[model samples]
Target: MTTPIQIGLLVFPNMTQLDLTGPLQVFAAVPQFVPDPGAEIHLIWKDLTPVSTDAVMVITPTVTFADCPQLDVICIPGGYGTDALIEDQEVLDFVRRQAEGARYVTSVCTGALVLGAAGLLKGYRAATHWTAMDMLGAFGAIPTHERVVVDRNRVTGGGVTAGIDFALTLVGEMFDHPTAESVQLRLEYDPHPPFNAGSPATAPADVLARYEELIAPNKVRRREAVARAATNLAG
Candidate 1:
């Protein structure tokens, strides 16, 4: 019998729902496209309750931290809630324990900050939301400004929607190019953005400035949180 590939996605309050669900849909479809894919995804949290997301969506976790099965892949998705998670020892401990045995440790957007808080990203090249890319340095990670970054067993995606690209990349890594391509075709994963304002370099200067100003307070909070988390990891 083929052993099942266990995958866990950590969910928390105020997370960006797409960050967790986008990759989930891709991974869930693997069994149909690949023979005996054996991929099983579990939504895990500290408790089994419905967690509210940044948007109007809410998700209930399938398992608790203590009862989660040993995983082949562990993924963390980011959102506004990440600021609080950076200082959460329980969540960090859970991530540390799972990462020790998982084949892949991955993150989307600011979720990398949580991984960093868990001491998982030390010396790894990772990616995160563009706004927080520089913050990876506090956790000893070399931050790369790309949609998806792969360094050894650590794979990370930038921003919210990039989780789709990250998931496809993981599929390619776990299976093959053909399998990933097949999944992409099945999902019609094609990009044709009407505007070229995805990145700071491409965005209109005024638009970018407006967003920066809007998020300034959050950034300050995150910086302080990262500092505290880094200090905790150091000791």
Candidate 2:
């Protein structure tokens, strides 16, 4: 029998729910698409305790870092939690160890910052939330402003919604284009946002400026955090 593919997604406090769920929804459909070597997905954390996302709901981890099997794909989902995760040496170490053996090392949104902190993105092209794109250089990464980026085995998605796209891309890579297409079709993945302001480039200048102002303080804090993480990784 073919060994089952293991996929682990890190879950932690203050994570954006969609960042984790979008890709998860896609991965969960793998069995229907690929029968042999089925996928086993795990929501991993430092411990088994339930953690709250930035949204209203809470998610309980299925596996602790200590007990997580070697994963074929290890994904880090992004959100405000990453601000703390970048400074967390324990989490960084776990990620580093997993990346050493994982077939695919991936991230969604600011989760890329966590991988960067773990010294995994250096010299690799990566994608992250647009607000955090500039910070990638601190970790020696070339930041790409795309919805999804695949460089070697490092797959990164732009922001929360992009997680779906990222996972579909991975599905294509792991199985086949037809499988991914089927998964997308099953999910009814067609998107037509009511507004075109999903991106700064597309948003009106005034709205974009105000949003930038709103996030300015948070950006300052994140910049400092990234700087500290990058320095620690360097030392």
Candidate 3:
């Protein structure tokens, strides 16, 4: 039998741990359904060292981007480092090259920011952390406000929680609805976030404003970084 689909899951410092591991659980649990010994899911990193999240979250790297085998899929996740990692050449390069090689490229939350930085968002209709979608156009992506946006082979999520939806969608794509449904059932994937504050529109006006104020600094930095990436691509 052919080797099972290989997935390259990119992780970085200050990433919302949930963004990476949540979708990870979706994919990792696939083996129980497919039971194909060849299926492999790798937690990739910039280096072999342990990486820390914004909330002091940390996870060891299993493979560096360089050693990342040509993958069937690549998953980029997001968190506090969204802005900073945008300007990181190492992170940008890894995302760019790996995405170029992968059959499909996906992101969760502001993880779309990384794909934007890698110049992969151009012409794609994608979703991201609502507050950050404005920056997507700076990189030429036509941003959409949805939990999951799929344009060609590029799949993006709205925020941290959307990772589960993103992965379930992919499972349906890679295999079939039965495969996805099976995995979803195993995950008890029924979701219900108690607060409506998850989306900009669903939340109260003042709460949205507060969120803007909190992320404003990162916005300035992310905007500049995206502009630079766009400029570099133009040249």
Candidate 4:
């Protein structure tokens, strides 16, 4: 019998729910698309407790870091809480250990920052939320502006809703295109955004300026945090 495909998603306080949930929904649907060996997905945190997200939703971790089983894939989702996680030694240690054995080490949005903090993206091309793309260089990563990027075993997705596309890509890699297409059909993954302002290049000049200004303070904090994390990794 084929070993079950084990996937673990890191959960933390103040994470963007969509970052975790979007990819999660696609991975969870794997069994419906392809049977037999199946897939097992788990929410991993410091403890098996409920964690609040950036939005109104709260998620409970299915396993604690200490108790998490060996996983085939480790996915870290991004959010405001990533600032704290970048400097979190315990969390970084857990991620580092898991990535050592996992077939794929992945992230969505700012979650790539967490992977960078753990020193997993060095010399690899990765993707993250547009606002934080340049910051990847601080961790020795080549930042790419794309919806999803795969460099070796490190697969990263761009901001927010890109998680779904990232997960579907992962499914296609693990199974086949037909299987992923079927899952996408099941979820009715169609996009037709009324606005064409998803990125800095596409957004109106005024809108882009406003977003940059709003995130400036957080960006400063992230830079400092990433520098410190890089130091820790080097040490």
Top lDDT model: 2
Cα lDDT listed for each candidate: 0.94, 0.96, 0.85, 0.94
Q: Which 10 consecutive residues of model 3 have the lowest summed lDDT?
A: 30-39
lDDT score, residue 132, model 2?
99
Task: Give me the candidate number with maximum TM-score.
Answer: 2
Model 4 deviation from native, Cα RMSD in Å: 0.9
Question: Scored by Cα lDDT, where does model 2 land?
Answer: 0.96
In order of appearance, the predictions have TM-scores of: 0.98, 0.99, 0.93, 0.98
lDDT of candidate 3 over 27-70, digit per residue (tens): 99888888764359888887899988867778888998778888
Candidate ranking under TM-score, highest first, comes to: 2, 1, 4, 3
TM-score of model 4 vs. true structure: 0.98
Q: Residue by residue across 1-235, what tens digits does model 4's lDDT show?
A: 6778999999999999999999999999998877768899999999987999999999999999999999999999999899899999999999999999999999999999999999999999999999889899888899999999999999999999999999999999888999999999999999999999988889999999998999889889888888888888788
Q: Candidates 1 and 3: which is better by TM-score?
A: 1
Clashes of each: 0, 0, 0, 0
**Model 3: what TM-score?**
0.93
- Off by more than 4 A, model 2: none
Pairs clashing in candidate 4?
none
Give RMSD (Å) of candidate 2 vs. truth: 0.6
Worst 10 residues of 2 by lDDT: 30-39
